[model samples]
Target: MIIDTKKLQKEVLENKKNHGFNTTDIEFELLRLYGETNELFEAWRKQDKENIDEELADVGIFLLGISEMLGSGLGEDITNKMKVNRKRIYKNRDK
Candidate 1:
């Protein structure tokens, strides 16, 4: 199935608002994302490739929620920046 990431992100934020997740809950989500990423890294280290993809997807979901809360389109912004940086940044760093 196709996913509309923007819509999904919006829904996440709306749900959080509706459920009244306070500042501490938001902070908890951020910490959860960090822990998920750590789990992904640990799975990678163990060469357990299967679970890593799911864990990383979990991280992406939380990150999208946080970014939406912050009024940011992180995926779009990052992709756009990478396009600009691909040539200049890599070339300069290689020098």
Candidate 2:
């Protein structure tokens, strides 16, 4: 499915407004994003597929909302970054 990030961003912001979530504080958003990532990590560590998916979506949702709050296009930024990455060379890191 094709995802419309602009529309999703707007919807995310609207949901935040409806739920009375923090919309103006970038720091708070970043902290929330960090927490979501930690949750995602915990889900992965537990090998819980269901919770893993939910936490992954939560991370993406926070990212979309933060992009909207910053007046940035998350989709466009990703596309552009991908293009740059494609042209770059990288070495595999040891695990």
Candidate 3:
């Protein structure tokens, strides 16, 4: 099934609210992603690719959640930045 990231984020925040957690805030979500990325790095170092993938997904979910909460289109922003950087870094690498 295709997941609607915005709807899933809203649902997660609602569940957190029902449980007395303030997940509507972007900071909390960002901290969660930071922890998740650390875990993913650890798993990757241990050669646990499956767990790494799961943790990466968790990171992406939190990133999208925080971006939506903050009204930022981070996916597009990162893509545009990477495109410029790739051209500058890779296009002249042989020179």
lDDT of each: 0.79, 0.98, 0.75
Candidate 2, 1-95: lDDT as tens digits: 99999999999999999999999999999999999999999999999999999999999999999999999999999999999999998789576
Model 1 — TM-score against the truth? 0.69
lDDT of 3 at 95: 50
| TM-score head-to-head 1 vs 2, winner | 2
Off by over 4 Å in 3: 1-22, 89-95
lDDT of each residue in 10-54, candidate 1, tens digit only: 887777679886423667888888999999999899888889888
Report the poorest 10 consecutive residues by lDDT, candidate 1: 86-95
Q: Which ten residues in a row have the lowest lDDT in candidate 3?
A: 86-95
Give model 3 RMSD, 1 decimal.
4.0
lDDT for predicted candidate 3 compared with the true structure: 0.75
Query: Model 1: how large is the Cα RMSD against the reference?
Result: 3.6
What digit string (tens of lDDT, one per residue) describes model 3 on residues 1-95?
75566666666556666878655677777777889999999999999989989998888777766766776665566778999987784555565
**Candidate with maximal TM-score:** 2
State each candidate's clash count. 0, 0, 0
| Candidate 3 local Cα displacement, residue 52, angstroms | 0.8
Better of 1 and 3 by lDDT: 1
> Could you arrange the candidates by TM-score from highest to lowest?
2, 1, 3
